[model samples]
Target: MNGIIIGQFIPGDGFFYKVDPRSKIAGIFFLMIAVFLLKDIYQVLGALLLTFGLLIIGKISFIKVLKGLKPIFILLIFTFVFQILINRQGNILVDTNLNISLINIGLVIILFVIWRFLAKFKKFNFLLFLGFLFGSIFIFIYSSFSFDYNLTSFNLQIYEKGIEMSIFVVIRLLIIITLSTILTLTTKPTDLTQGLESLLSPLKKIGFNSEDFALIISISLRYIPTIFDEANKIMQAQASRGADFSEGKLKEKLKQVISLLIPMFIIAFMRSEELADAMESRNFVPGKARTRIHELNYSYRDVLVTAFTVVFFAVALLFRLNVLGY
Candidate 1:
């Protein structure tokens, strides 16, 4: 949960902070669409560069933005591997016969078991661990050990197009995550609510309650950090009571997780009740018109930024469709 950074705001007076929240929100939405429209590696790289540029302009640390990727690291790697294995469009870069035997399988299992034990004694380095594991697997497959009987024989082919597609997928995902991080880091929850409400105000003509919608959005964003904090506290209390969440068998870990989740749910319900009572006491009502302490006002910078985003969207669409012979 700590690895998840969505809806959490970091206070700063950078370029993004000064920009109108509506413009920032719209620009981010457009940029994400543009990123998805891109197919070529060069277009993806350009989008990534632009994302990093926004991060720098917002005074956000690249390390902090990278931290946002932690929760999705495994997913990204899985996507990469899946793409590599399934894609067969281009020429094969790697074609080799993998010798699968009982002896080899047992040795690989033993190696993994040993690695797992070693991981417990110190902090785990994911990159080094994955490198070692894959290196071992690669060496095992490409070794000269041959069995008398061919249990199973299949050629593993890696295509050039697969590599390119995987790279594009990973880079596009990173760009989206980075841009979202920049948005949350620079914009406050209140500002986000205001921007959302302002943007959705046109829907009021169709009987939509924008204020109520905004209130729900604001509360959801505001409670994300609080819920994570409470979860940490609950986990710590469980740990103090001899609960081993980390080094447990699958069944035991599931039981331990249940223990944590039940308490979290109870706490969440209690908090909701308390909030309702507090709001009721203050005569709060849904869909009520309220004046903001800091009203959102668009400046010249906001207009210029919005126009630039429009041009970017147009260019991306044109390139994607090959309208300009890209």
Candidate 2:
């Protein structure tokens, strides 16, 4: 809501956007240190709280924010399920598969995800809908198994501490993933290039060319999203052709995926060729000087932000060393 569109750049004086890309970069680094350095549960919880605060201050809706977070939910659940039973350190709490461990972890993830997107709850109604969808699928599978007259059931036992730690780790990953996305969403690729160049400018004397490297890195950053969109389109077309992806057995499904992938690769190759021609037509040459239209002008705000990021990182490091945050 910082008056800047979520994925599109709007030229505005949002304090975060205006505080110099280099300082913003430093802030990200500081946040990483702060989040990872603290072993204290309270500290970790506080960090997430602070992250949400920053999210709000940036005027990004928690709904849109968690919409970004939702893509990684499968990974979160996978972590939960695996850690629930796989971790053998702590004492087992229950014998049933759907015991306290599973319930606790499932609830934690469900709650964290919900709270993480409270601003525009309606937008995340799809998640609730998807939850119902998966629940229905699971029921269908269970009924199918029961109709086969299989009386036995599989039960997984999990430890309590593992559940606790798993929740923490997954939540931490969420924060990191969300923040990383936020960085790219809020900052322009050109701004990011300058940030990287500035950060690595010190290495220029060591034969590291930041400008050229930054150019390629930004191009690569641009390439991933482009490739993803293209792949999605290809898949949609294949789906329309009745290319079944979900109904087959594992190997059969894999073959279906491969069939889809071959076209994707072919298209990617075509795209690369076209990109090469475009670059050639534009007289693209690496290791060359070019004037930038949007120049970086650091104000006092940028200086203060930089100093604060450095100081915050130092303090966080000291906390890790047990000199602070006790």
Candidate 3:
């Protein structure tokens, strides 16, 4: 939770910060669509490279972006494994017959225990690589310990297409995540709200309230960090009261979680009430025309950036259609 970078803004003087928020928002939206439309590995790689280039230009920390991904690491792994397991269209990379035996089962259990222990260490990349290496070796070894007359027999088959598809999915997810992180990190909440309102202003002709939409977005973004901080404080307070959230059985953890959640809910409610009261006192009302302290203006640089983004999107679409020959 601490590693979450979404909805948090960092003050910086980078190119991304200088660009118009509307341009940044539109660029990221197009980029995200392009990422999902990508089919070839080379196309995905190009998108990733472009994302990295943006990160560099924005002067964002690569480590910080990776840390932001830690919260979804399990989801990414599950997607990878699920894709591989369910896909069976390509050439077989691994096809082995296995016999189930007491020794093999015990060895497998022991290997899992060792892996769990090692995973508790802080060397994430090293441990992941080691886990993959050892897991493959263990499967081979277990298959080799086959008995002529066994209680059960099994076959393991891994397909090349499955591996390729899983890689593509993982890369796609990473690119989208990186791009979103960049957007939130570089753009301020107020700027984002104004930009969104500007972009959606046409909706006013169709009986939609763009300012209300922008206000909702702004409030949501503004409250994310506040909620996180409140949750952290509540957690610490509970911990000081001898509540154990990190190490405990399922029931105990649930109780600890409830203790934390109750306080957070109360805090959030009170904060909302205060915000409403403040707005009311200032004569704030929904769907009312308001003047901004600062007006949004697009300079020549903004036009150039927007044009470049449109060209990039065009290229990506052509690549996806195979008209550009990858």
Candidate 4:
């Protein structure tokens, strides 16, 4: 749970840390749009390289970036597998018959046991799951000694197009996640809130409560880490009470989940109420104008970032339009 970094801000002395939050927001917005606009593999690779360059410029270590990607490791693997399975548009790479048998089932159970045992090692967590995934696949695919008890069998065909598409999608996803993580890693919550309010100030002319909106966004972002920490604590407490969340039937797992959720929701509500009371005690009015302790100022670096992002986005748009012959 702690591997997630979307809403968690990391303190750093990087280049992005000094840039205005508004500029960072705008830059990330454009970069994300550009990422979506990419059509070909080369464009995707280029974007990936650009994102990594930004990460290095921001002085964000690769370890932290990998940690950010850890939470979505399963999702990425699923996406890769799904894409590979669904797309059969090219030359066949792997053609084999997969069987579900006692051998396969036993191997899978053993693999699960191994995974559960090795999951305690934080550094090899992703590698462990990855190895487990491919090991399971190989076991099912090549285990010829089925003891004449095969439950089902199917032919598995993986094509070049599938592999290409899977890599493309996974890389694209990584790029998107890394870019967003970079923003949140470098910016502070209060600065983000004020920057958003400043950018949304013009909306007040249209009867929109910009401060409320900014505060809502800020609170939501700030609550992410808090909620994850709370969930972890609750899980640990439940585990100490002999609650087994991992090894259980579906029904039992659901019950265990309920046990976790009830307290979580109660705690969330209590925190929200406390926040409300604290705000009220501070005379925090919904629509009142407020002075900032730190004002956001755009430097020349912000201007360069904005301009570079604009160019990058324009080029990506051109690629999408097929104007670059891509």
Prediction 1 global C-alpha lDDT = 0.84
Predicted model with the maximum TM-score: 1
Among all candidates shown, the one with the greatest lDDT:
4
Q: Give one digit per residue, the lDDT tens place, for model 1 in 197-292.
A: 889899999999888888888888778889999989999999999999898899999999999999999999999999999998998977776776
Q: State the lDDT of candidate 3 residue by residue for 1-326, as single tens digits.
A: 55565566888888778888998899889878878777767788888888898888778999889987989988998898898888898799988776666666666677777777777776785576567557755764455443433567668678999998888899999999999898888888899889989989999999988888888887887788889988888888889989888998999999988998888888889999999999989999877789988677788768877786787789888887889882
lDDT tens readout by residue for model 2, 175-209 = 78767766766788778788889799789899999
lDDT minimum window of 10 residues, candidate 1: 142-151
Estimate the TM-score of every prediction: 0.80, 0.62, 0.78, 0.78
**Lowest lDDT block of 10, candidate 2:** 140-149
lDDT of 4 by residue, 1-326 (tens): 56575656887799999999999888898899899999867789989998889988889998888888978988998999999999989799999999989878998999999998999997797789889988998898878782558989999999999999999999999999998888878888788788878888898999988789888987887788889999999999999999998988999999999999999999999999999999999999888878766877879999989998999999999888988882
Task: Decide which is better by lDDT, 2 or 3.
Answer: 3
Shift of residue 63 alpha carbon in model 1, Å = 0.9
Candidate 4 achieves a global lDDT of 0.88
User: Candidate 2's error at 178, in angstroms?
Assistant: 2.5
Error of 3 at 31 (Å): 1.0
RMSD of each: 4.3, 8.7, 4.2, 5.3
Error of 3 at 200 (Å): 2.1
Model 1 per-residue lDDT at 249: 90
Q: How displaced is residue 321 in candidate 3, in Å?
A: 3.2
